[model samples]
Target: MKLLKGLWIGFWSGLILGLLLKWIQSVTGEQVYTLLLNVDFVPVIGSVQWSEITEFIFHMIIALVIGVVFVYVAKRRNYSFGQLVLISLLMSAPFPFLYFLLSWLAVEAEVPAATDWSAFLYWIFAHLTYALLLPILYKTFERKNAVSQ
Candidate 1:
């Protein structure tokens, strides 16, 4: 049950964030995901450019896990909006930064190099969106559940 709830929150939040980021890219013509998504992984879901599809799936999983963790951390406590915002930013930043840094230093990864500012900024804002949405959606759902119950 917890997993489902988390996944639901994470997946939707991730999707919404992803769309928002895409829109940003479209508008700015900026390569927001230059580092993170530009990889040479074996295509698991798409044609030659499997990264697109795989990346989306990866984000959904990340968001789901973030939500689950939030639920656990949140428990019965009502976090202030600022706290939730901080939580969202904190929740979203580390994994990719570490992953890219480690992969680049440790394994000569084919993904974007660590200094890709555009990608980093995109990553931050994308996570910010996810972070922002996760709580709002989760709280709304929780409130509705409580009302029904």
Candidate 2:
């Protein structure tokens, strides 16, 4: 049940994050998502043009892994939902930086200019959204466990 909750939360959180990022980029005239998509080593195998179905599946898998890991790590630390969310956010901080670095190196693409505050802000917003949603999902699942037992 906990696992199922995690997966469900992950899907919603990931989808929301993706949509929010896309919206922000569209408004700001920045292609932040495109930048991340173009960055190699982010695990998009096969042709660069992945179908929508493939992308959805890949995102869900990634989100599920992140959700499960976050819950497991937080439980191991004996932390509450808020603490787990905070820790997960902190843990995920390196992903964007690594993405930036990899984009700079392997892709030969100039990283989004630091002057582009909108891009950075969009990235932060997306990360925060995912971090915030993850714990809520865990809490909901925990409640189900309590009620069932």
Candidate 3:
């Protein structure tokens, strides 16, 4: 049940985040991601070319891990569903920063090679959206659980 919950949250949240980010990029005329190779001496440590399908897969995987970890941590803390959602969102706050740093390092083993504030803003909005929706989803699902019980 917990695992299922995690996967559900992950899939939906990831899709929402991805779409929102893309939309924001389109509207702002800013690119959310940059090919590190194009930046400088940023050898492609790893690259996921911006394909919708590939992006979906990657988002799903990352969100799944995040959701699982969030639920596990929340359970350990004995938090209510609402509380868990909030905590999980807060916990995920650092993910964007970490991702940015790792991305920059992976590309060029240095900072400032790819310092896109838009990416950070995109991540913030996406994460916040996930956080906001999570509690609502939890409540909806919890009602279902109650009915089943």
Candidate 4:
């Protein structure tokens, strides 16, 4: 149940985050969206060109893992609201660094440059939005479950 709850939150949050990043890229002409779906760094998988939906599914799979871990930990720890909020923020805070890591690791992938400040800031905003939505989604799921129970 906890796992499912986490998956639910993760699915919605990831979808929203992906859309936000895609929109940002479209409007700003940044490569953030491309970065999000890029897998050119992966050795075996790098050889094949993936459709955007397939790449987005890869992203969602990661999101689902993150969600499951977060909810499992939260359930076990029984954290307070403030603590959950903090956890969400702390968990998401390092995401921007992932951009740099990907940029550094990318071979022929067209990702954002390591020093694109605007894209970095946009990435930060999109992640922060995800962080903010996590608790809300978790609580909503909890409430719905409670009512069902």
TM-score of each: 0.68, 0.74, 0.69, 0.94
RMSD (CA, Å), candidate 3 to true, equals 4.8
lDDT of each: 0.64, 0.67, 0.60, 0.88
TM-score rank order: 4, 2, 3, 1
Model 3 ranges off by over 4 Å:
33-51, 76-78, 106-119
Model 2 global lDDT (CA atoms, 0 to 1)? 0.67
Clashes of each: 1, 0, 0, 0
Error of 2 at 73 (Å): 1.9
lDDT of 3 by residue, 14-107 (tens): 6776677667666765544332112333345134344556545655687777766655665465567778666867876775675465555554
Across residues 5-113, which tens digit of lDDT does each residue of candidate 2 receive? 6567777777777777667767877766555444344455533756645655666678787876776676666677778777877867776674456345444333466
Q: After superposition, how far is residue 12 of candidate 3 from its true place, in Å?
A: 0.7
The positional error of residue 125 in candidate 1, measured at the CA in angstroms, is 2.7
Query: Which is better, 1 or 2, measured by lDDT?
Result: 2
For all predictions, the C-alpha RMSD in Å is 4.4, 3.3, 4.8, 1.2
lDDT of 3 at 39: 32
Question: For model 1, what is the C-alpha lDDT against the true structure?
Answer: 0.64
